[model samples]
Target: MSDRSATAVVLGGSVAGMLTARALASVGVRVTLVERDALPEGPEPRKGLPQARHVHQLWSGGAQAMEELLPGVTTRLREAGAHRLPITTDMVGLSPRGWYRRWTESHFMLLCSRDLLDATIRAQVLADPRIELVERAEVLGLDGTGSAVTGVLLRAHDDTRRTLRAELVVDATGRGSRTPHWLAELGLPGPEVREVDSGVAYASRIYRAPEAARDGFPVVNIQPAPRTGGPGRGGVLLPIEDGRWLVTLFGTRGGEPAATTADFDSYAREQLRHPILADLIGQAEPLTEVAFTRTTANRRHLYERMSAWPENFVVLGDALAAFNPIYGHGMSVAAQAAVALRESVEEFGWGTPGLARRLQKAVARPARAAWDLAIGMDVFYPGATEKGPTRAERLVAAYVDRLTYTATGNGRVARAVTDVMSLERGAGVLLTPSMLLAAAVGPLKPALGGPPLTGDELKRAGLQ
Candidate 1:
């Protein structure tokens, strides 16, 4: 099939799905997006996105890819009240080893409510004449043999079922995707799967930031110490649009926070490693009730490893790999995968043999980078896996733990670590001889006794 004449069907209207449709459309492929929910017309709440209530940020790496897919998207987000905050420079974080000093900016993050981010991108993609949206519909299954997918079996909201044939079918449905069952029905062997459940529960709430701290406020993160031989606990305070600070408190297994508003403040103050989050929230007025969820787990399906693969079908986003939100790599990896999809189609003709397999493998590259980062810490948690972390994981974690410790006081080491953490560079950067020497030498200065918040920030938050 020629690129201009090719048709594609994208399942799910998520960030991944929307970006996939945009990418295909950019390559001259007509795209149909099937969504189960009636998407909100603006930056308002919608169903099936429970995690949207929590803190969400796009690291510079992902933001760049989104910009490539849809030009001027970041500008639109800024016009709609998003903030582009430089990493480390605009961040105050406490890692497992110690508090990270605010170093010069090496990368950045796009900060705002997930609702605003989605609405901006949605408006941009839907305006393209090559892409059509089919809302309030359910995707029943794939419509061909295990060797190839010809189309999809879709059911409308009114129980009307139909087969919509297409040249390509992309699955971007999130953690609840049933593609495995659908593959089994087509007589294909199941893909290798792995899950690392940290048993963390998230409770988030919004507050009106104190007037002095409403604008140009730094992101405050108190990260969990996973090696403590106890349930991990952490919290983050993000100053988003409309002068609101979105606060999310999380704890693993035995340390999970309570869902009630009464316990929210106490958990941040007493349960987490620091009381800064609690102090900041105390000075602000509550804007919404606590939003809670415990579905945070790192799960991956190795579809690319399958010996016999189907053509014209590819899985992207959370359907291929879902990470614990604590790491905040899910959206970034999905954006990168969509970029890979577009580039693959451009490089190899869309109908080339083995194209689907090539796309799946290409998509896994970003997911693998993110998976290692998440499992490095999560795998050490109690009961994260039945057999515990592999020997390779333990060795890698030991090195990463040391590097993280060195990053606390060394500016050069901090920048190197941020490169990988931001997804701009690969994990191999940490294995360089220079990095090895830096880790062995340890931090150049003594550890900080408190969060590295400036005096001005303290005064603004009324903590001083």
Candidate 2:
């Protein structure tokens, strides 16, 4: 281990990297965040993240983690046009089980442009004097071996070779991370890998909100059913800041949506299970052109379960696990993972033996929960079930479908489902005796035939 214990090389500049660096900085570790692309000065796009062109949601679980790491982060995000949408209550959703009643807010989600969200978190992390960034720097490999990683080898993003080293290394490089290659180079056995590709594609566009319906707008969602043995199609119309609505429509494989504005309206109106989202956007003016991305996949690298992991090396964020964007769990899970890292570091103190291993294992605990949720549904896609869903998968999916169906009317079941959706509680919470009984009993109240929007909401949106 390096004697100074002052500097750590953080590979990546996205939310996960920034948050990880922020966590390290809080513990007195001077961090250098390496980014191959130049970060935007404001809420703008960066080359590294193509998904930024799409709408993103920050779940309450993630929001809570971010708030803990950086005080007033949610406030900052909201001040920048991000909307904190309450769960179930604020969401009009149709699940595989049935139409979810617009019950009271069980949880909440922050809706906004990916660029603005990144910029907000980036600015806060960069403001910390101890956390510095090395733009145009690319991580090459590890400096040490299986026993313990001494540092990282980095080069100018443009340089073909030559690298700079640090005392400790963190891989927060997102879904495309090369940690596996680096580990092989160090002679360490590669960790197990798990993936469930939903064959999901996302098409998103920004809309100028009408003069009226700006504040207190609800989120509209229609989920696809995997059990139907047909393509899953989903849509969302969310209220962001600056009088804008970020609408994203997505489908699996054959049902993939288009990015063209013309198709945006048509798809929403014709393709989706509900007409609410399409209707909402019909009244709003088109802002930016539509953006399309099909790279959304459910993948996870089991670094924590590695038989022989090097010390002084850790992974966080998408680099460790990535989920389908449709679920909107990525950011929140990243924040939660960063918190695990922070707590682990605090427990062991800096440079303690087995600290990195302990943190990796601890962080993976929540990661396992999230990965299970994403792949559980994703693996049911047509091509997704190529390998076939396990017996456990079918069982769990059935129970979840029942739970979602129950939540449509039963507030208790709705709360239980929301607790997991918000990620406020673990999956085990749903398996509780009360939840099982509730599921068996069915919804206690009658289900709504349509969205639970009040007459006032319709008036605000200029609904005919």
Query: What are the TM-scores, per candidate, against the unseen true structure?
Result: 0.99, 0.96
> 1-464, model 2: which lDDT tens digit per residue?
23566778888999888998998888888888889888889988898688887767888888899999999988998888788887877887777767777777778888888888989999999999998888887777888877988877767856766555566688989989999999999898888888788789999888887777888888777788877777899887878888888888999978899878889889999998888888888888888888899888888888988889888899878888888988888888888988998898888777788888898987787788788888878888888756769999898999988888888779888888888878899998999899999999988787777776778888888785
Estimate, for each residue in 64-85, the C-alpha lDDT of model 1 and write its tens digit: 9999999999999988789899
Whole-model lDDT, candidate 2? 0.84
Best by lDDT: 1
Q: Of the candidates shown, which would achieve the greatest TM-score relative to the real structure?
A: 1
Model 1: residue 323 alpha-carbon error in angstroms: 0.3
User: In order, what is each prediction's RMSD in angstroms?
Assistant: 0.9, 1.8
Output the lDDT of residue 28, model 1.
90
Alpha-carbon local distance difference test for all models = 0.93, 0.84
Candidate 1 TM-score, C-alpha based: 0.99
